[model samples]
Target: MGQKSGGYDLNLFANPPNCNFVCSVCHGVLKRPVRLTCSHIFCKNCILQWLARQKTCPCCRKQVKRRSLVYVNKLRKAIGRLEVKCKNAEAGCLATCPLAHRRRHQDSCPFEQMACPNDGCSMRVQRWALAEHRRYCQHSAQWHCPLGWLQ
Candidate 1:
């Protein structure tokens, strides 16, 4: 909720979301939406930041206050049910997950990025490819000793 950006990228969604689910301020899918006195909804952070500069609704220019804003739980649940593409989609990940489960999918995503373990190797490779990468890495130990120690 403390995210600098108030919402999600629209393009991340598997299908276009309803217009009401979009924040008029940041122009993205509403995240933690809050409804104003004027019946307009905006992302919580977007409205709060707007109130900081001007105490008027961005949609209808109606006078509003921080105390008048209401958290919209139903809207939040609906948005969470929407499907989204994986952040690593371009990295050969073909997973589409519920918005609420995005973090869970990322946690186990085989294509998730990981830095090389070898010293002096600055390469970043997917988790599924790390073993192959480590085997060929120039910075890795050259050979294994008979006593099972790296030589």
Candidate 2:
């Protein structure tokens, strides 16, 4: 469970999770985990997709039926409390947030790098700095008027 995959080590959080909490299919933090009648857990979507192809528990290979799946709300809440590094950490973002909020935070993270809006400028700017960069960007002069247009 400590192994790295897709730039994230699911077991490296402030509160390390047991192997049971990791999704076998994606090998990542279990998002919306569900439990099978066989007592094995998997991400809800993962197991659904797996069941679509084969009707067996991924871990024990026990025969499973779609109706036997149950949402693991307690486990999901526990995982949500664990603190994890932002996915953009390598991009200079140093924030850490709860697993439940990680996706939302990443979507609005100020440190996320984005391409300059000006047609000729190739500079990459952090999301927080994009507005300032656009203000003085020389290439923007062609499309942006400093004075208000009367028409």
| TM-score (all chains, Cα) for each model | 0.86, 0.72
Residues 1-151 of candidate 2 have per-residue lDDT tens digits of 3333221356446556777778888787787888999888888877888899998898899999999899999999988888988777777778888888888987899988889977889999889999988876777854444574422
Superposition TM-score, candidate 1 onto the true structure: 0.86
Worst window of 10 by summed lDDT in candidate 2:
1-10
Best by TM-score: 1
Where is model 1 more than 4 Å wrong at Cα?
1-4, 141-151
How does model 2 fare in lDDT?
0.79
The collision pairs in model 1 are none
**Candidate 1: worst-modelled 10 consecutive residues by lDDT:** 142-151
